[model samples]
Target chain A: MNNNETTAASKASKPTHEHTHDHEHSHLDETELRVRALKSLLSEKGYLDPEALNVLIDTYQHQVGPQNGARVVARAWTDSTFKQWLLEDASAAIASLGFTGRQGEHMVVVENTSDVHNMVVCTLCSCYPWPVLGLPPSWYKSAPYRARAVSDPVGVLAEFGITLPTGKSISVWDSTAEVRYLVLPEQPANTEHLSEQQLGELVTRNSMIGTGLPDPASAVSQ
Target chain B: MTNNSAKSNLTATADVLRELPDIPRRDNEPVFDEPWQAEVFALSLSLHEQGVFTWTEWAHTLSSTIKEAQRDGDPDLGNTYYLHWLSALEQLIIDKNLGDAAQLNKLHKAWDTAARNTAHGLPITLP
Candidate 1:
């Protein structure tokens, strides 16, 4: 082989760490190591299709996520009729808005009023509203969150740096496989003029999960 | 504006996500913290398609694994979420008689060798 072809051929044949330490060795976490191992095993066994894996990852990583839910929250906040419909029959209202699928088939949008605050958790497992909220965060799926959200909603909120009113009664919704819950955080005081899209900018992932409030419209408006 | 924003979320989502200092995000989107998390997640779904285990079976295994970890004094901090997921997958593989413990271990070792010998950012390939 000529000089260029020989170089290219060797590089192609020996694409390994032993080639040269041109860059720092990247460390893979323990779970990551195991996952890679398992993935390879499955692929070798003809069970894991790389194309199918990419499709699933792309769906959650890009196409579906909390952004879908945020838009729903913003619309509910701005449109009174939509809000009413959402409260009355959330699944239909949300699906009407085009955010409907697995883990969101039976949605329950709980309102957070001055006298009451709502928090959601899955005491049994991470049964979150995936269509709107996407996958549950690590914190949402944790044992502490699942265990304490029901018994002490306020305390759980405090841990998240959210302190509700001492007099306000907190309601902890334990989401199930049959139904999912989303928190419609009270529209902040000075957000009447914001457009639905602008208001949706205020809605955050945690707000829909009841662990946080929407970003104040004033912040975005300013 | 509503129609436009719904169709395009990266910009607006990024703005608000920046304000929440405590939450982990990439490109202003809430996503798996590591590649492994995503792989394991999709692995479960892919395996289901392979009929390795039903969704109900997978969920039950995962839930029970979490419960067992909790009973064993696992703090269940954010980190362990996917570890339980991996455990569930392993359990299902063995339970379904797809592979025994020894075979799985051998596969794991092969990957480890490939990983050790592979260059950073290069695909891990087994001979």
Candidate 2:
């Protein structure tokens, strides 16, 4: 494979990748710098407090995220009593685990069965339960996702490489500021003997979003 | 603004929070693939907290920016949401007299040039 004698596809793909990456990277860098510049301006002008900025960043970065949601899902899979309690009153059940705050004041838990699969979306905006699930991925907030999820959920799921069984029913729940929804993905097979922690290890953020599935292979590999 | 007027204004801002959803985000860590998106998010929130602008005004600015982008033939894919956010932030800063448009433009150019010259995986410092 000589660099000068590359195939046409390879040659084209390389530049496209580089161009796209460069464009996006530069845009991101520009925004980051602008924010930094703005911070300096505000700080110098005495309009902003540095300590508050750190606290906000620290809270989002560490104190909140998907692991909290994973714990709740894992517990539901292992404890029938708790699962029933969760289905009846999610806010209380989640608060029992001590993950409650802004964006999670009202929560609705939808369970996935063999015949029915649950998916979550916010057609108008991104409304996620930040206290438990953490911040959302960039794709979740994209225009294509917001518009497509409600209109063609299966197709959208397929685009994420998730192919459901032909006869299975798909339900798309739209989240709003008043109520946030979480998808309780069906537990994978052959994990009956596993502990709650072990079950949680199998859950991915995408699985909870219904854009992905829990694989037994991941558990084995780890 | 008078104390009563300010109180009403703040209540209107609070009502906007109740009615509309701002800060489009998901439930995993690092909501953005790029670091700059988070920076923009934090900057807006920080400014709002410092009383530079109400969240309601920021939300309106961002929503209008997205709407304008759509009118201009944006395909409405989710990827451009943050671009609207950045645009709104810029406009708000200028409108509020918190930042100089000329200075921002200068810094943007400097950052772009610096980023282009820097190697991949290295920290980009504005010259």
Candidate 3:
């Protein structure tokens, strides 16, 4: 077709798509209004309070997250008996460390083996092992992580810069009723001669969650 | 002298109030007054809002659960209370309608916003 003819044809098609797009925009606005109304109803029945809500939000941000997980990882590295106990019964074992029974009650610990590795996701929601590990990271609670982690764990982990060896199948545990999991990462190599405190330094929060293993070099540098 | 120290003292008092703990009440007596309790309370309330359980049920469950924990020799009040609170929240979230797959999508988005940039706290953007 000639250039003008082609241009005329494209112009005719553009309006249809634009009309659909505008329709979708308004549809989304209406949906948002419904959701807001529902949420407001939930809030009004004494179900939600702004002050309490702020406190919950603040606790997750300031008190939980990497810092809390680090404590669990450090303890696991320094104490062999505790590591065994943690793998066996995470809740009771964590209680032994004076960090028991919080947001993640139905606690289970997954041990990383040479042939198989494990990661956790709460596909239904952001169910986490909060007592031992503290609040989950934003990514952990994300749908992309929750949905993809089960079906394509290696792929998801790779996005987090974690690459598993060939022939190693990744087992993704879905946190549901009566069972929540924490990952017991493999201890770092060449740290046999290090003191317990030094070993503890090698353990990072990511290691405990099985996303990434600890780097001895960074630990020593810090 | 010239009222500067007085002003400094007032500022210090405000700081103290900000740092004040939310204690668990026993016959209106403050028992587990600690910063952590506030965290537990907030989590519990969030779960309740999500409809995990009614407040009455939560109160009953928590009281019994705490007693059991104490019996088991885990007497750390703040931690134990939080443990119960967490359980209640989890159950509540699980129990809610959660409605369709679209609702799940909305929750995922909400969680992402809440969890990220969380250096501050839970965002006001939660639906």
* TM-score of every candidate's chain A: 0.78, 0.78, 0.69
Question: Model 3: runs farther than 4 Å from truth?
Answer: A1-58, A195-197, B1-127
lDDT of candidate model 3 versus the reference:
0.55
User: What tens-digit string does per-residue lDDT give for candidate 3 at A69-155?
Assistant: 556666777788888887887788867767655433456777788876777766654556766566555455444555556555555
Best candidate (score: DockQ):
1
Best by TM-score: 1
| Candidate 2 lDDT by residue in tens digits, A1-222 | 234334433656565545434433323355566766665556556766767766767777777788898999999999999999888889999999998854324787889899888888766556677878887777786667766566566656766778887677777787765677888889998888788998888888878887778666766765
The per-residue C-alpha lDDT of model 2 at residue B30 equals 49
Worst ten-residue run, lDDT, model 1 chain A? Answer: A18-27
Residue A199 alpha-carbon offset, candidate 2, angstroms? 0.4
Cα distance off (Å), candidate 3, residue B63? 28
Candidate 2 Cα errors over 4 Å, as ranges? A1-47, A103-105, B1-35, B45-64, B75-79, B88-127
Candidate 2 vs candidate 3: the TM-score winner is 2
Q: Rank the candidates by lDDT, best first.
A: 1, 2, 3
lDDT of each: 0.74, 0.71, 0.55
Write the candidate numbers in order of decreasing DockQ: 1, 2, 3
Tell me the TM-score of model 3.
Answer: 0.51
Q: Judge candidate 3 at residue A141 and give its lDDT.
A: 45
